[model samples]
Target: MKNFSDIQIGNTIGPREQFVSKDECRAFAHSSGFAAPRFTDDEGARKEGLPGMILPGNMSLGLLSKFVTDWIGPEGGAQLVRISTTYRVPVQPDHTLVFQGFVTHSVPEERTAEIDVWIENEEAERLVTGTATVRFDK
Candidate 1:
């Protein structure tokens, strides 16, 4: 939103795509202190009964944040004050992830709003769900 007043309940951002290869996820895991084997190696993930190396929960959250920010654009007038997410499935590497969000509540007087967000795979499986509070600076 260019201004806080532009926000309306039920207004949506996107079903935008975010993709990461095994190399990218591994690089993120290693740098961010989440470099456990299951997140770094397919073999290690198999040992844990997973099909392959997967992104950790924190990485998923970061991707969610990126989605919101990208939607807000470069000259953002909104500040994501708070965000909470629940992970439902493992986010696999080299996959097309979709990020979508909608406003659930709006407080125009306070210049704040609550947004519901979710990330799904190409197959339409929800990998994570979350809510965020954003304040707009006029």
Candidate 2:
């Protein structure tokens, strides 16, 4: 686990891959209350002006959040203060998603850090982009 003192500006966490299966997409849709056709049904998605069944913004945020939590370790190590994301493209099901991060700022005195986070498709197209702020434990 990376500690607060170990954080450095421009340090990147990953280009790690996660394959989002159709089943996983459907599961997230059901569990997260994003049962919109755009998320659950391909035909419904097309009717809704989407290319096909897609992942919800919240689900994508969860993926990014998990990435952060995994990086800085357990709750005792650091707490995620905030995260914000902008969806650029519909995250389709059954694609390998690439998660990435860059430490943009760190304040040792305040025990805080900010990371630029993103998720990209196998084609390297960015699906979500955001910044996450973390508060380190004393």
Candidate 3:
């Protein structure tokens, strides 16, 4: 677990990868109340001019959150305070998305850190980009 003192600006956090599966997309759609056919059915997605069934944007955010929290560790005494994201492209199933994050700034007085995060496809095209703020109590 990294304490507030251990976190520093310009620290690279991760390059974790997750394989997006059809079933997982379907499950996320069902659970998230997102009934968009593009997220559940490839044929429907094709009809909409998409490459294939796509994962929900929020699911991608969840992946980013996991990447950050995992890096901070359970005892890191850190909690996410804010996050903003922009989706650059449709994320389709069967693709491996690599998640990466880097600490961009920190405020020791507030025990806060600002991070830049992104997810890219196997071909290295960025699919999502975001900034996150986390606060550490310890």
Candidate 4:
């Protein structure tokens, strides 16, 4: 079981093996109750000057959370205490996004760690920035 200290500054966890397809986006939107037209209809998205079906913001956030969770292991292994983020751009359906992060701070005695997160496309342009805190019980 990995813990907070296991992750290192400048070390990245994943460009997890998943693709953000239109179908995947729609499914996530449906399951998440995100009913915006841009999230479901390509034409609607085009009208809004977007390329195609837009992924729900929560899905993007969930992906980032999963990357962090996978790095720290199971929920009981290290609990996520806080996360703050800002979406800088949209993730269209074609690119392979690399979700990356680094350890920003640590308090060994308190068993807590802070990490900064960012996601980039195949082109390497950052799309999101976030900060998170996790607590290691063990």
Best-matching candidate per TM-score: 3
Scored against the true structure, residue 93 in model 3 reaches a CA lDDT of 79
**What lDDT does each candidate get?**
0.88, 0.89, 0.88, 0.78
Clashing pairs in 2: none
TM-score of 3: 0.95
TM-score of each: 0.94, 0.93, 0.95, 0.87
Question: What would you estimate as the lDDT of candidate 2?
Answer: 0.89
lDDT of 1: 0.88
Full candidate order by TM-score, most accurate first: 3, 1, 2, 4
Candidate 2 local lDDT, 56-131, one digit each (tens)? 8899999999998888766457888899999998899888999999999988898899999999998889889999
| Per-residue lDDT of candidate 4, residues 14-65 (tens digit) | 6554667777788888898866779888899999999777677788888888
Clash counts for the predictions, in order: 0, 0, 0, 0
Error of 3 at 125 (Å): 1.0
lDDT of 1 by residue, 1-93 (tens): 468777788899897887889998998999898699989999999999999999988888998887777777888788888889999998899
- Write the residue-wise lDDT of candidate 3 on 9-121 in tens digits: 88997788888789998999999997799999999999999988998999988888888888878776788988898989888878888999899999888999999999999
Instruction: Give candidates' CA RMSD values in order.
Output: 1.2, 1.4, 1.1, 1.9
Name the best candidate (by lDDT): 2
Better of 2 and 3 by TM-score: 3
